[model samples]
Target chain A: MEELGPLFVHPYQPDQFWILILIVSLPAIVASLYVLIRGQLPAALSSSLMILLPLVAYLLGDIHLMDESKRVNYCGSCHEAMSPMFETMHNDDSTLAGFHYKRGAISHQTACYSCHSGYGLSGDMTAKLAGMRHMLQTALGSEDYPLRLRRSFDIDSCLDCHAEAKPFRAIEDHRELDIQEALLARDMGCTGECHETAHPEEARHGAAAFAEAR
Target chain B: MARFAALLILVSQLLLLRIVFDTTGPPSTWFTFVGHPLVAAGAVLGIWALTRRLIREAHEHKMAEREDH
Candidate 1:
C-alpha cells in the first residue's frame, strides 16, 4: 500500500511543536525555580515564568493533541481491537472504508476520523471526547472489542459531502422521498444493504479472532 | 505554596510530555484525568503566592519610609 507522509511535517505541527515547547519549558522551569527560591527575580516575573508559560503551553498542547487524535494511526494505537479495522481499511477492497481509502475519496491519514466524526464543532468535540473515553477504557483494561460506536452512525455526516453531489442525486432510490427521510432520520443506514459496512466482518468480530490467529 | 506549585507544574509537564510522545497510551489517560487539573491548580497557587509577595513588599517599603521619617 502507498503510504501517507507523517502528520507533523512542519515545525508548527503538533509533534514538532510539542517537542519545541518541551525544550523551552524544561530548562526554563529549572531556572524559574532557582530564581523563585532565591528571591532574585520579582514575584510577578517568576510567576509568569512558572505559571503563565506552562498554562499557555498546556492549552496549546491540548489543541495539538485534539488534532492528533483525528489521525488514523492514533485510533489504531493502544488497542489490538482496532487493528483489523485498520487492516480492512488498508487492504480489504469490498468494504466502504477500503474503497474510499484505495480510491482517494477520503484522506488515508485521517480516514477513520473523517467518516466517524460528526459535523460541526459540537460533533468534533463529541468525537474527541469519545476518543478520550476509548483511551481511558484501554488504560483501564475495560474495553469490550469488536468496538462498537456509542450511537448509530449519523447520516448527516455522509450527506455533508454526498447529499448534493451529482452522482449521489442521480440514484433513483436516493431520489425517493421516504427513503431520503428514512436516511435523514437514520431509520435507514447509508452503509446498510445497498452500500454494505464501512469495514470488513472481521473488523467487527473484535480482537478475539486476531488473538486466536496469533 | 511555592514548593507545591513547582511540584504540580513539574508533574503536569511530565504528563503532557507523555501524552505528546505516547499519545494513545495509558499515560495519556492519566493526563486527561489528572494532569490538566494539576496545571490549573498550579497556576492559581502561583498567582496567589505572587499576590501575597507583592503585598508584603509594599507593606515593608511603607514601614521603612515611616521609620526614616
Candidate 2:
C-alpha cells in the first residue's frame, strides 16, 4: 500500500487518526450509555451530551471520511478492477496519470482525485456520490471488469487546475481562439485531439489487456 | 423524544465508529452508504428534538410573561 503521507493528519497513523476522532466523541458515547442505563437525565445536560457532542463528532467523522475517500489508495481498494490503473500510474510514464505521478505535479496521496474530481464543494460531493455508486456496484457483483467510467470525463477537472497556469497558456496552439473556445466549452477534450489520454485505451483493445494489466 | 434522539445518536455513532475502524482502504459499502445516511439522520433528529424543546420552552416563557403583565 502507498503511504497515506502528509495528506492525512500527521503524528498519527491512519487508524490512529480515526481513533483520535472516536476519542473526541467518547464523552457523548459514555453519556449516551449512561442515559440508556439510567432511563433519563436533566434536560439541559441530556441535550448537551446526546445532541451537541454527538453532532460535533458526526461532522468531524464525516468530513474526515470524505477526505480519506479521495485518496489514491482508497480508490485502488477494489483491487481487481483498479489494479491496472494503479499499475499504469506507477509503471507507465506514457499516460497522463503516470506523467503527473512521475513529475510530482499531484499529491501521491490524492493523485486520482485531483484530476477526476472537479473544483469546489459541489465537485467533491459529486465525486463522493459516484464513489458510493461504485461501492454499491462492486458489492452487487455488477461492476464490469476493468470498469469504465459511467459518464464522459469532465474537461473542467483539467481546466480547473491548468487553465491559468503559465506553461499551459504559453503554448501557441493553446492560444488559438477557436481551440480555446472549444476546450472551455468541452467540445474538444483535453486529451482528444492533441494530448495523450490519462490512461491507455482500454476501451479500444477490449478486456484482455485490462485483465492482463491487473 | 429525547431518549429516542439519544438512541439514534448512539446507534449512528457506533455505525460511524465501525466505518472508521474497518475502512483500511476502500470504504465498506454497508458503512459508507448506510452508515453515513444514518448518521446524518441522527444529527437531523437530534437537532429537531433540541429545537422542539427550545420552542416549547419559549412558548411557556411567553405565557408566563403575559400572566405577569
Candidate 3:
C-alpha cells in the first residue's frame, strides 16, 4: 500500500471526530424540517429530539475530554477561527512546519492551539472578546477585509515554543552580512555565492514543467 | 404564514451569527448545528409572542370602543 501523507495519516481529536458525525447528521436535520413543515409536529419534534439528544450527549463528552486549564469555552464558544498564518505554515514544504505538527519537534507539543490561545482565565476572556468583535463584524455583513497576512504572522508565536532551540541563529547570521557591500561587489549572499535558493530562479522560471509532473 | 415568517427571521439571524464566527472559512460544524436551530426557534417564538401581543392590543381597543358607545 502507498504511504499516505501526514494530513491523512494523523487521527483527529475526539471533538473533531464527533464534529464529523454531526456533519453526517445534517440529512436527518433536513428530514426533520420537512416533517415539521408538513404539520406533523409530533413526528418532527421526535426526530429533532432524537438528533439533538445525541448531539448534546456528544457535546458533554467533548467538554469532559477538553482540558480544564484551557477551557474550550474561552476559545470563543460560538466563534470559528483558523488563522491564515497556520494556512501558510501548512502550505510550506519546510521541515520547520512539518516537524512542529508531526510530533518530531518536542518544543511544539500541542503546537498551534497553545500559542494563539494564551494561558489561563484572563487570556481566554481576552480571546473571547476579540472573537465577539469578529463575530459582530460578520453578522453586520462587513466581512470583506483584505487578507492582512502581516497582522496574523507573528514571529513571537514561533519564538514562544522554539526559543530554547536557537532558531534565532539564522536571523543573527543574516544580520551579520553586509548586504550593501555584497551587492556592490555583485556577489549577493543569496545567489551565486553562499545561500542557494531552495527553489532556484531557473526552476521557478520553468515551474509549469514541474507542476505538470505533479 | 406566521410560522414561515418566524422561520425566515430565524434563518437570517443564524446566518448572521455564522458570518460573524467563521470569517476565515465556513462556520464550524458546532456553530452550524447549534446556532441555526436555536436562532430559528427563537425567531419563531419571538414573532409568535409579538403577534399574540398585537392581537391582545386590538381586542382591548375593540372592548374600549364598545364601552365608549
lDDT of 3 by residue, A141-199 (tens): 45433322223323344445544665544566434658545543545433234433222
Colliding residue pairs in candidate 3: none
Clash pairs for candidate 1: A146-A206
Model 1: per-residue Cα lDDT over A1-214, one tens digit each? 1255665342333456776667656754674466447743456566667777788778767876777778888888765668778777888778888888888788767888988888888888888888878887777778786667667887778888898899999999999999888877778788766788787766766666865654
lDDT tens per residue, model 2, A99-210: 9987878878889889887677888888888877778876776766445666667887877778899999999998999988987776777785799778777722334567
Every model's TM-score on chain B: 0.90, 0.72, 0.61
Task: Write the residue-wise lDDT of candidate 2 on B30-65 in tens digits.
Answer: 656666676567667666766777788899999999
lDDT of 1: 0.76
Give the residue spans of candidate 1 off by over 4 A: A1-16, A19-24, A32-41, B20-22
Cα misplacement distance, residue B36 of candidate 2 (Å): 3.8
The DockQ leader among the candidates is 1
TM-score attained by model 3: 0.37
Residue A50 in model 1: lDDT: 77
- RMSD from true fold, candidate 1: 3.9
What tens digits encode model 1's per-residue C-alpha lDDT throughout B1-69? 666777777778778778767777566677778888998897888777777888889999999999999
